[model samples]
Target: MADETDEPDSAAHPFTRLTPDLVMDATESVGFQCDARILELNSYENRVYQIGIEDDEPVIGKFYRPERWTESQILEEHTYTQLLADSDISAVPPLIIDGSTLHEFDGYRFSLSPRRGGRAPAVDDLNTLEVLGSHIGRIHAVAGDGGFTYRPLFGLQEFGLDARDAVVAAGYIPAELMPAFDSLYDGILADLAALFERVSVNTLRLHGDCHMGNVLWRDDLPHFVDFDDARSGPAIQDLWMMLSGEREQQQNQMMHILRGYRQFNHFNLAELQLIEGMRALRMIHHVAWIARRWDDPAFPRAFPFFDSERFWSEHLLSLKEQWARLSEPAIEIYD
Candidate 1:
């Protein structure tokens, strides 16, 4: 399993200063009496914990990565989730404390949420996929008008063009492997740009990162957590990651999902064409994410494979495979 945990290595990382006592105190500062039982959750970009309360259920404390988001950008995410919750969507919005959702204590910005618990959904189950699709459809229905004013857009410039530049500048690629890396990357980017130009998609506020890892399965439904990556983008950005397995299997999965999806919002057939391109962008952006954060001690520990030539070599091959996938006809959705 990948080291998704984000525990920092002492003062070498910003979160090094976020001690257990501080975590409990931060929880208490928000009006809850801590029982001194704080368990760190699995997260990398930010530190999250489940804190026990004196006479109540435990609550979640999410300490935002310092300087990663401005107050406005964070609040916009809060408001978007609130919109979804208001529409009967199963979204975990932060608790409103002292008339505000955003709070700060001891130089750290954090928010408290009622702790939600569930196991990851069985993505292969057709019923589960259908249920997941309905929830996402409802989310998009509510999100149609609540476009974020401060959040970023999921697009080529940030995820593709800038990502390509960052990895090259990070100097992680072996000098000998640079040519293969450059050729594959440049071709992928050019194709991605042309693909984006070809498909005119309707962008809206989205969960931004809606893979199975961020979803919790309870009450036979999908509850979306971590709108941290929430941003304005095409609706498909929220849907594609749920798909897995071979081509026919993924198509069957999409069929079930859209069966529930189209009941709420119109499913644009054109957006289907961008799935591979979107996948390519996510691939490139993910590596760039690791590269940009390499300076953070925890990142190296979690992604040790990244330090090796074998990793880059495998990454290039994966990119080559994805590059070929981009040329194939988009997966067809049938009745």
Candidate 2:
């Protein structure tokens, strides 16, 4: 329930222009009757809402952040989700109106989807973890059939160096912490690059941000939502985020996940080596994501810990620890 207008310079926050009236008009523009009841969902990168329609089930309306993605990239995501649905995968595809999934209203691009609800999956449950793994495996099977020509690739230059640059450029690090931040960040990237050179894995279209939050569970089944982050990346990029706990516990979890994974598609165990590297990239990218969106009112509210000397100090320490983990042997799964 944070105010979308909390940013001092409102003009810098594009979402501030997206008033409720505009939302209602946008829904009606697409031939859906609005009941004037809209609940803003939990999202900062883009504005999302559950809008009620007269005489119909409420629909989820997602307004894409302007200039963030090209039309081709958005359509590619829609096509991918539709393909998943066609294959009987539990994914929600954008609703097609007037022979198109993407729609424009008042200069903003948006998509509508039927409202689907479920609680977050219990990833710690071995059975649930395997099921989730199988679902991702099936999604990957379809993804590997082809490549995304327009989507960006997940690599050190994009997720690591560029991310670090964004933070520095934004002037987020306090003067006192700049040296520590720069030194630690440079070292982390160097270690990550060395690790990447040691192994090569196939990159495919992926759920991209396949964390537990993006998955919804119902009736003991898992359905994925939010492919906004979908891109070309290693299969392990989709797998590493679900793991937690001590190294031994994570190893056990990976075994169960791969057990379900291999049933659908051949998983390259070599990709296991990329786990910690991918983790480091995500850590860097997350800070960059926040830094880039700091002008948005929601970001400052949600990530109050950012832009502080203490936060950067701890972040440096975390990267150092991760660098050590990168040198250790990758997790192994056996029959």
Instruction: Name the best candidate (by TM-score).
Output: 2
Q: TM-score, each model?
A: 0.95, 0.96
lDDT over C-alpha atoms for residue 188 of model 1: 90
| Model 2: colliding residue pairs | none
- The lDDT per prediction is 0.88, 0.88
- Backbone Cα, N, C clashes tallied per candidate: 0, 0
Q: In candidate 1, what are the lDDT values of residues 58-108, reduced to their tens digit?
A: 999999999899999999999989988888898999999999999998889
Predicted structure 1, TM vs. truth:
0.95
Q: Local error of candidate 2 at 138, Å?
A: 0.6
Model 1 stretches with alpha carbons more than 4 Å out: 1-12
- Per-residue lDDT tens digits for candidate 2, residues 155-191, read 8899998999988887777787778787888888998
* Model 2 ranges with Cα > 4 A deviation: 1-8
